[model samples]
Structures are given as C-alpha cells and as structure tokens.
Target chain A: MKNRIVILGVLLALGFSAQAQKYFTRDARVQFNSDTPVEKIEAVNKSGTSVLDTQTGRMDWKVLIKNFLFEKALMQEHFNENYMESTKYPNATFKGSITNLQDVNFAKDGTYKVTAKGAMTIHGVEQEITVPGTLTVGGGAVKVKADFVVKPADYKIDIPGVVRDNIAKEIAVTIDASLKPMGK
Target chain B: MLKKIVLFLAVAGVIGAGIGYYMFNKKVPSMASEKSEVTIEAAQLYQEFEADEAAASAKYVGKIVAVSGTVLEASALEDGTPKVLLDTGSDFGVSCEFDPNTKHAKTTFTPGEKLTLKGECAGINLDVQLARCVVVQ
Candidate 1:
C-alpha cells in the first residue's frame, strides 16, 4: 500500500508539471499619466517583458526606466537624472501572482476579471500593491490589461517644490500585455 | 541714468525668460545624428550583460550603442513602433525599438538578415532593450 501511494504521488507531480504552461511577451506597453491643475504629463515604455505561469498563477514583469519616453527632452532629462535616476536604478519590476486564479480559465476563451497582488520595485524601493485588471484568453493567447494608481512618495520618489504642483501626487498607470504560450 | 537702468533690467528679464522657455520646450534629440559610443556584437553584448548586469549597465546603458547581429524576428509594437530582435546565440535576443522621430529607410526585414543598429541602451530585461534606434546600414 505504501509503494502504491508513492507511485501515485510521483505520477501526480509529473502530470501537474506536464500540464503547466508558461506565457510570455517582450512588447508589453506601460503608460503613466500625471495630471494636475497646472500641467499634464504623460510617458510610455513599450518594450516591457512579462511572463505568466498557469500552474502557480505566478507573473513577472520588468521594464527599463530609461525606455520611458517623454515628449519634452528637458522633462525626460529631469525624470532620468533628477527623479528616477535611471542610470543607478535602470529597471522597475513586479513579481506577483493572480489572487483569484479560479475565476479565469486558462484553457477557455473569454474575459475574466482578475486581481494581481505583488511587490513593485521602483527606484530601489519595494512595496506591496494590488492591481485590478482584466484577462482575456483567446486563440492560443492571453491578454492582460490593468489600471492602477501609484503615489510617488510611496516609492520614495521625491519631487522638488519648484515643480511640485506641476506633477501629480497620485499618478495613474496602465498596463497592457498580450502573452503567447512558450513553445519548446 | 535711472531710465537706462530700468530698460536694461527689462531686457535681461526677457532674455532669461526666452532661455527658460527654450529649455523647457526642447525636444528629444534625434538618434540619427548622434555618434555611437560603443560598437559591439549582439552576442558579446548579451554575454557581458549575462555575466554581470551592473558592470554591463554601467558600461552600456544610457549610451548610444551600435550592435550588429543576424535578425531573428521583426515585429511592430501595438502602438506601431517597429521592434527588431537580433539573435545573440541565446534564448533572448538583443531587442531594438526604432525611434519614431527619425524616418527609417526600411521597416521590413527577413529572418537571418544581418544588420547593424544604433540606439540608447535601456539595460536588460531578460533581453537587452534599445530605444530610439536608427539603422546604421
């Protein structure tokens, strides 16, 4: 009976591993908007990398800070040199998982509301955050769209008083990624 | 003398404001006119980043780099930005996102085609990424 149980356990592990699939994309887009009564600021980065695992509901995302493009060159310089310090901390990352994986069927084709909770690391600061988004599974692909607000102070990003009112206290962030199954 | 002094002050203030306005509204520089600070092959660049990210980032990131490699894949971003992947003999390739400011001679490429591109390195995220890229050849 013990041998049969051990055999069953091993078989179960193998089956789970075999069914687990990873989805990935290197062209995810991340956009952030900062709007105040005095001014409006927007920036975007298109080459974000992300990965998702079906079995564990784990997701990982990363984007290079210097990749974020601004319309005004001086604003971009101030952002990289003064604010983000992109050279010292070149990347921002999020490593988390879907909290309600049961709501979304990875094998089926439809849209599901999902919540992702994870640690977001920016400017060398890590903070836990929950983001609400929608996931659509269709035609051998998965699409993720999420909108969340981030406070610069929470990330230790300080804006000087000179342009304090020009920048928003809470910046709105949007993420869109279409992931495809990783093929062996 | 007071009238002349007041006129001088007004002229100086106008000049200062003009400089400030120009600086505030300056546009991002075009990559086509910028010189490449580092010219390295895709495999070597990827190897350096893989071996040591900080060292590679300090050496390459935020600088205009020229990478020559065989094209693995060419695709456009959802926002219509052209992106090309250069094979680095690894699972991930050196990725280049073309600059929208500069007009490219060609936006299409066949796999296995060799090309050199120059852009500002934005560090690695599984794959090294370059932004505001311009084709060298």
Candidate 2:
C-alpha cells in the first residue's frame, strides 16, 4: 500500500507540473510612434514574442528591430541605415516579473491591471523600467496591452542634427499581445 | 554715370550667372548612389540584427557593406567550405559563408576578435530565417 501511495504521489506531481500555467505569443505586436510636425511616423514590429509564467509571475519578451516596418520605403531604409542601424543592433528584449500576478486569476474571465517591473534592453543598452498593463484572461487565452516611453540617447542612438527635430527624443512604445497555452 | 551703372549691372549679372552655372554644373556629392558605405561596427550591427533579422538583412542586400562582431561559431561545409558565425553583440547574429578559394578564408579571423567584414549583401534565408550572407572581403 505504501508503494502504491508513492506511485500515486509521483503521478500527481507530474500532472501538476504539466498543468503549470505558462502562456506565449509569437505574434505580439509592438509599435513605436515618433510624432513631429515635419513627419508623423509609426513603426511596428509584428514578430515579437511574449512569454508569461503564471506560477512565478515572470514575463519574458523579445522583438526584432528589422521587422519594424514603416509606410514609406525611403523612410524604412533611412530607419535601418541611419537611425536604428538595423544591421548593427537587431533586437530588443524585456525580462521581468509581474508585481500583481496573484491578483490575476487566469481560470476566470476578467480584466486585471498588472504592474510589471523588469529590465528592457534596446539598441544594446539595458535599462530597468516599470510598466503597467492590462491583461485580459479568458477561454484559455491571454492578451496584454501596455504603453511606455523610451529615450533615444539612453540607448546611444544619436539623431543627426539635420533631422533631429523630426524624431522625438523620447519614443512612445505600445504593446498589444495575445498569448496561448504553451502546449496548445 | 548711366553707362557706368549699366556696365556694373551687366558685370554683376554675368558674375551671378557664372556662380549659378558653377552651382548647377559642378559635381555635388549625391547622397544616393555615392556608395558612401561605412563599415558598421560589429557590436552595433549585431544589435540591429537582433531587433529585426529579416528586415535588417533585406535592407543591406546588394550593397557593399562592412560589419564587425564576435565570432559565435565556425564550421566547415561539406564542399570543403569554411563558415563563420558572428555574434553582432545583438540578439540577431549572422553566419558568413566564405569562398573556399580565398586565401584569407584559410586564416584571417578568429572567435571574439570583433571582426569587421566587407561583403556584398547577398540576401537572407526567409524560410529557415538564417542571415543569408556571402563574403566579399
């Protein structure tokens, strides 16, 4: 009977580990807006990924810079060649823990305000940032929405004097992500 | 005095015309097609690669470019070709395929030398998502 109990315990442990709530999205959309009277430009990175660990309240995200597309082709080229230097610095990432993780109940359908504090790395510079976001959890799916600002000089991105007025010193970034259960 | 004034005005007009001609006819460096290609530092290039691999690779395609980064991994091709993997210090890294015939390919770069490579942007692998590269230098 003891051996059978031990076997049952092992199976229960495996089942709990398998059911650990982890969510991910490969198609997370991150957009950056730089508005100036000279040029109102918006760029979107369509191929970003965000991973959410419910058990630990840890969140990880990565986005490719080259994928960020602009409406004008010339502007796109200028962005890669001149501004972001896509060939030189290609990705941005965030790794942080959700401060209000316990407040979110993934099993229930509801909207919860979440505060995530983590290090955001961009243009080869890493900065610690706290971002507040709204998470919608329902039907085995999760959606995240957040907006924040980052300074260009902080990342060592030098805007040339000629077009410095056109690009803002602080860029506004918005994130809208949909995540699914890892195995699913 | 009227004649002198007319002469002065004509000379001024001639000088103005000459200056205009110089301005229009003299070679002004064209920002486009000038091939003012600058070798991007390896660390910077890697950062760009990490941001957007496909878009970054597409932007540099068919251009004379130079990039520097650390060597991540290097290996030999089945056809006796040598390949080098470079980490641009960014999330996006690239594998450079060198022509086996080149002497420099035999021995020029080592891992973590912050190598600056000059090459024609060959294009990228959209399928496997590898940084498609060919060595020019």
Candidate 3:
C-alpha cells in the first residue's frame, strides 16, 4: 500500500510539472514596413500572447489591433479607426501548431525549421495560412523568427481607393520572439 | 480679362496652399499640452516594470507621466475588469488595468491605437506577470 501511494504521488507531481512547462510571452512584437519614397511606418502590440505546447507542438498567438504605432499620430488613428476598425474587431488571433515539433529538442542547443499552419483572424476575417520560420532552442530557451506577407483583402480589410496606394495591398509582417522558461 | 483670369488662378493657388498647410502642419486642438509633463519611451517603462515590479511601483507611484506605445491586446478580466497591453517592441509589456467605475472606463480606448497614456503608476501583478496600470490617456 505504501509503495502504491508513493507511485501515485510521483505521477501527480509529474503531471503538475508538465502542465507548468507550457511557455508564453505577452510581449511578442509584430512589425510591418512599406517603402513609398522610403517612408517607414511601424507598430507594436505590447499585449501580444504566444503560447507553445512542447508535448503537442501546438502554438497560438493573439494581439489587439489598436496597439500598432505609426510615427505620424494621424496615421495611427486612421489605422485603428478606419483601416482596422479595431473598435468593431478588437483582437486578432492565430491558432496553429508547429509541424516539425519532433525535430526540436529543447534540452539541446540547435536550430530547426518550424512549420506552423493555422487559422489567423484579423479584421473580423479568418484565413488559413502556413507560416514557416526558424526556431532556436538553447540554454533552456526558445527563439522564433519569421517573415511573411498578408494580403489586406484576404483578411477583409477594405482600403478605400483614395488611399489604396498609401497602404500596401500585401503587407509584409516580421516576427522575432524569444521565450524563457516559465518558472525557476 | 486675361489678367483677371491670372489673378483668380493666383488666388486659387494661395488658397490651396493654405489648406494643404493646415492639413499637414496644424496640430489638433485637443492635443495641446496642458502642463509640463515627463515623457518616457514605452520600451524603457516596460523594462523597468518587468525588472522589478515592486521597485518600479514605488518609484513612479502617484506620479503623472506619459507613455506611448502600440496596443498589443485589450480585454476584460473574468470579473469584468478592463485591461490593456502596451508593447514597446520588447518581450514584455505593461498591462494597464483600469478601474471599472471610472467614467472613461465605460468607453474610450480600444486595441491597436497608438496611444500616449498619462496616468498614475500603480503596482505590478506578480501572479499574472503584468505591470499594474491605471489610465490617464
């Protein structure tokens, strides 16, 4: 009986530890740039959340639209109020899983290509996209970097003809994130 | 008559230039600075809070300051507490939690708006890993 109880306790502890292993970052930054006479605009989402599941190779990210910043304050306002309509559609989320999960060994230091395919919702439109990126695992940490293009129309973001050329039809997005162990 | 036409053209050009200047250079009236205020970059403020929430809270508590950043996420807590994430291009963000009873809390800001927030710095949340925030934007 004593041995059986000890085994049960060990199993419970393992389960708890596994649950705690899930890593997340709320400070993920996604930036986009367009070159028109070399004018650069940038925005950051401070409340972005990226979650990774080691056991299942699943990852998820969510961000709010009103969080993007442009050097010109007017541009920023128009983005949220007119372009993104963030008040109506406040949040964007990506639900995807890493395909090369098995290739990553978090305990070792190496770089691996990670393929994430999932539904991304922006501007109240959801589309399926596959994002391929590099993931570096080392020092008990994971870092991811990827760059991809997203069509505004694909996500139902309608830009009026008057300013259509001001914004790109296809916006290039870049993501570079690093994640540390959740707890000591 | 040709001279009159040229005069009208010149007047129209002047009017057009004036309109263009107003649109491009005129600052919004409501944006006028009310008082001398300290402006801190969003990234620096976020790092300060992340490095030590308690210490940051003590240093900035009850001080009126302005921070500018991109809105990362905004949502209501389980108990209907409104919260916003301010990202400064870093891995950690400052979470602004507003009082439910505040008038502005009913409706003001939303996600994705680059905002300059002026507020009294509250404490940080150790459990949720967030910098406790109030709103003065």
Candidate 4:
C-alpha cells in the first residue's frame, strides 16, 4: 500500500510539471491607436513574438518596430524616420510576469482575468507597467488578450510642434496572442 | 520691373508649394503592385542576419526583397489570416505576414513546399520578419 501511494504521488507530480511548460506564439497581434480631438492615428503589427511560462508566471514579448504598419505612407515614414527612429532601436520588448498566477488554472479550459506587471521597452526606453488581461486555455492552446496605454513622451519620442496637435500624448495599445506549446 | 520680379517669385512659390503638398500626401504602392528591390534566398538572408544584424538591416530594411525558400510551417491566424514560416536552420526562421484582404481560398502551403515571397524586411528579432508579403511562385 505504501509503495502504491508513492507511485501515485510521483505520477501526479509529473502530470503537474508537464502542464507547467512554456507556451509561445510567433505572430502576436499588437495594435496601437492615438485618438485626440483633432486627429486619430493607429498602427498594427502582427509579427510580434511572445513567450509565457505557466509555472513561473513569466512572460516576454519582442516586436520589430518597423513591422508596425500605418494606413498612410507618409505617417509610416515619419514614424520610422522622425519619431521612433527604427534604425537606431529596431525592436520593442516586454519582460514581466503574471501577478495573479494563483488565480489562473492552466489545466482548465476557461478564460481567466488577470493582471501582469512588466517592463516595456520602446525606442530604447523602459517603463514599468501593470496591465489587466485575459488568459484563455482551451484546445491545447493558450490565448492572451490585453489592453493598455502608452505615452510617447515616456519613451522620449518627440513630435514636431506642427504635428503635435495631430497626435495624442497617450496611445491605446491592444495585444492578442494565441500561443502553442513550446517546441511544437 | 519690381512688380514682374514679385509676380515671378509668387508663381514659383505657389508651384513649389503645390509640388510639396503632392509629395507629402503621396503613399507608397502596395507590395503586389510594386517591384521587388532585390532577390535572394531565405537561407542567405537568415545567414546575413545572424552574422551581423546591423549590416543586414542596413541592406534590407525598408526595401522590398524577394525570398525563395522551403516553407517549414504554414498556419492561419485566429482571425483567419494566413502566415508562412520559411526554414532558416535556426530555432526561428523568416515569418511572412500576408495581406489579410487577399483571398487564399483553396491554397495551402504545407511544410517542405517551395515558394517565393516579396515583401518589406522589418528587421530581425528571433526571426527575420517580413510584412505585406505576396507569393510570387
């Protein structure tokens, strides 16, 4: 009886460990919108990569700055040449963790609302941020969704006085990713 | 004579302003309509990126490139957008993001399929990224 109980405990530990593996996505969608009374500017990037470890509650995301596409060609050029300076800082990244890991059950197939805190770096500047998000685990996949706000001034992005009114100080950002098991 | 000089200056200024306005508003052509700036294999591009990212970016960034390679993976996004990944002998490879508006009906690129893609290089992270990709062959 003692040996059988020990074997059962080991099997349970292995099963739980397997569920703690990392999940990732190569094409995470990240969109940003700047809506002011005078103007509305927005861009979308679908080539962002993100990784999440369910056990450690850690997550990381990386996106190339040049991948953000705008509707207007001139706006795209101004974004890369004048504002974000994509040549100097080609990538934006976020490294953080899910603060509410205890509230999430990875094995369950349901949507869990959670908060994540991390440092987001853009244009060579890093800022600590906490964002509310949804994590859905279903069909052997993990999907994450989050909405947050970012300030251009915080990243030292300078807008010319002529176009200052055309852009907003705070930009609304949205992220959605459907991650697969690692090494898949 | 002064009046003629002022009139000439005013006319030149107006023409210049008009041209400036037109240029300012001009948008880049869609990738499907534009010509590829350069043609290279996916492996070569990946090698260059891995060798020196800055050098590779200087050569490929903002330019339309035509890359031919074998498709290692093809998947549709949650919103039904099609994406393809080419082999690069690394943990990560080149990911091509296609125009979501295009109809890819009945066309699926499975692994080990040969394809040529033209798009703008978006620089490298874990993989060399391309956007607005259109399949040529």
Candidate with best lDDT: 1
Candidate of highest DockQ: 1
- All models: lDDT? 0.93, 0.68, 0.66, 0.89
What's the TM for chain B in candidate 4?
Answer: 0.77
Q: Candidates 2 and 3: which is better by DockQ? A: 3
Candidate 1: stretches off by over 4 Å: A1-20
Deviation from native of the Cα of residue B110 in model 1, angstroms: 1.3
TM-score of each: 0.93, 0.56, 0.61, 0.87
Task: Evaluate candidate 1 and give its CAPRI docking class based on DockQ.
Answer: high
| Model 1 lDDT per residue over A1-184, tens place | 9999999999998766844488999999999999999988999999999989977789999999999998889988999999999888888999999999989899899999999999999999999999999999998989999999989999999999999999999999999999988764
Give me the overall lDDT of model 1: 0.93
Span of 10 residues, lowest total lDDT, candidate 1 chain A: A13-22
Please write out the lDDT profile of model 1 over residues B1-137, one tens digit for every residue.
99999999999999999999999988888899999999999999999999999999999998999999999999987778889999999999999999978888888888899999999999999899999999996
Model 1, A4: alpha-carbon shift in Å? 25
Off by over 4 Å in 2: A1-19, B1-137
Over all chains combined, what TM-score does candidate 1 have?
0.93
Q: What clash pairs does model 4 have?
A: none
Candidate whose TM-score is highest:
1
**Model 2 lDDT tens row, B1-137:** 99999999999999999987665344312222224254775555555545686675666644556666667656554334455666754434554554322345344456666555554443332111122234433
True contacts kept of 3: 0.00
Point out where model 4 deviates above 4 Å. A1-20, B1-21, B100-107
